[model samples]
Target: MTVTLKNGVLDPQGKAIEGALGSLGFSGVGHVRQGKVFDLELEGSDKVKTEADLKAMCEKLLANTVIENYTIALD
Candidate 1:
């Protein structure tokens, strides 16, 4: 799963990264947004139920829904 701040939210870390990249001679870099990635291994094989569980996890704890968005990808 990937978690990221929603648009229009303040991203101080990302801004810092952008400035660092500029100082490192990396040009044309802007609007860098930082995020998180999570990898979980579950015992279920049900796609529907697993997806539901993942979404629930995100809604309940994995992400701050008011300021961030989470995406789940199963493979």
Candidate 2:
């Protein structure tokens, strides 16, 4: 699962990173937003059920649903 703040949300960390990049002379890098990515090894074979469970996990604990959004991918 990956979690990130929704568009228009204030990202103080992202802003700080952008400033640091500018100070280091990395030009033209615009709007840096930071997020989380998780790699999970699942024991289930059912794709539908696994996705449902992952969504529940994101909603309940992994993400703050009010200001963040999450996406899940299976490999």
Candidate 3:
């Protein structure tokens, strides 16, 4: 039950920032992709609750709801 940045999504912000940095005389920088990861240590939490909590977190805080995306892993 993880969500991550989908392939083919244009990362304009990342590209712009990379471009700016390169223009500042810092070359050899390219291929910028922005994404997020969430690490959770559940204290033996139930599966349903964990999923609900994760979903809520993504909907509320983890994700941008506009541009940025996120992914969660149960490790």
Q: Which candidate is the best by TM-score?
A: 1
Candidate 1 pairs with clashing backbones: none
Compose the digit string of candidate 3's lDDT tens values, residues 23-75. Answer: 89998997767565556777766877887788789989777666556665665
Of the candidates shown, which would achieve the greatest lDDT relative to the real structure?
1
Per-residue lDDT value at 49 in model 3: 80
RMSD of candidate 1 to true structure, Å: 1.0
**Alpha carbon deviation, residue 6, candidate 2 (Å):** 1.2
Checking candidate 2 for backbone clashes, the offending pairs are none
Candidate 2: 10-residue stretch with minimal lDDT? 37-46
Candidate 1 similarity to native, TM-score: 0.90
lDDT tens string, model 1, 22-73?
9999999979989999999999799999999999999999999999999999
In TM-score terms, candidate 3 sits at 0.52
If both were scored by lDDT, which would come out higher, candidate 1 or candidate 2?
Answer: 1
Rank by lDDT (best first): 1, 2, 3
Candidate 1 global CA lDDT score = 0.96
Off by over 4 Å in 2: none
- Which candidate would rank higher by TM-score, 2 or 3? 2
